[model samples]
Target: METKFDSTADAVAAALRELIVGGELGGGERLVERDLAERFEVSRIPLREAIQQLAREGLVEVFRNRGAVVRTLTAQDVEEIYGLRVLLEGDAIFRSVKRLDEETLARAELVHRLLGEAATTQKQGELNREFHALLYGACGNARQLASIRELRAQVERYERLQNTLLADTPSFQDEHVAILQACHERNARRARALTAAHLDSARRIVLEVVERLAA
Candidate 1:
């Protein structure tokens, strides 16, 4: 398939995503196309294209009279996303655990350790993502994996905000260790339960941050 985006447009979109997620753009800030074009040193075409891309990703929305603005997510969004995560991720990991290979297990162990030491939200998010992917990637369901990735990208901003600004990120080391042990023991049921609880704990922590921010 032919790519729809040029390098500059893609770069513009990525930069915008970072700014918004990093809280540099601030929630509900108006995105004036001309101002953004000037700021990014890009033409109107790429700037508008980048906004449109973020819109599709649920990171930006345009009011009929308000043009484009950063989206201010709600507690409901967090609950819905992670409620689904419990089901989707639990099922995926359950399947993957039954099929785990030694190499993938080793990689996951290292990622879990890195995640424990990850001081910045960006590094923690990256390492945590890798650990989850290693756990779930063997599920034999490409579509499910893709959908989870998209949801994760949307939810990551809240996660980073919660951890980096509002409160210390909760350590998942115990849960991860338990889950890994269950997987190694070939106990799929225990692994699935642990994953569900893990995601639910995350949902609660993120919502606490969202409430504070909303206040």
Candidate 2:
């Protein structure tokens, strides 16, 4: 059976993932174990385990004795992540349309509601993740979904950074609604095109934001 510590550790991991994706904790920020342990109301052991898990996900880097830090994304990381996003999500949308059932589409609609709420409140980054995951899961390709999910997590760090700082970017809700509409119509081709376009737009916006921050 899972202990209370296990559950607490998982919660802390999720919360930290959100902070990272939301850019509350910026890139290269040091992760102090004891501080996090206190914040999460847990002990050091579980906190260390959570950090280790994040490291395996490529979202954190653990130094031998210096402790863990958020990984700093390079331009190359953004390029590769977006490139893979286009290939995987674009194809997944196409496949999903063919296999998607009414039930699945309805679930997707609900997920989009969450996305919209997130966008409206400027808390939609995580909801955006759920929206995409619902659509991708429809593809029924385990390996492909796994690969794309990893890429999504990697790029999301940058997306959060961009979204948090930009007051002028287009509404992410609208972008997601357009994709959902395409899926609702079962227009596979159009969905594929939109998926690619959405990712491309996100890449451009996020990269520009990163550049601005650097400047």
Best by lDDT: 1
Residues 86-187, candidate 2: write the lDDT tens digits. 988899989888677888778878876755444432356555666787787878889998788767776666665534423433455567778888888889
| TM-score, model 2 to reference | 0.80
- Flag clash pairs in model 2: 118-124
* Candidate 1 clashes between residue pairs 3 or more apart in a chain or in different chains: none
- Mind giving the per-residue lDDT tens digits that candidate 1 earns over 123-170? 887888898999999999999997788677777777787454224444
lDDT agreement of model 1 with the native = 0.84
User: How accurate locally, in lDDT, is each candidate?
Assistant: 0.84, 0.76
When summed lDDT is taken over every stretch of 10 residues in candidate 1, the lowest stretch is 162-171
lDDT of 2 at 209: 60
lDDT computed for candidate 2? 0.76
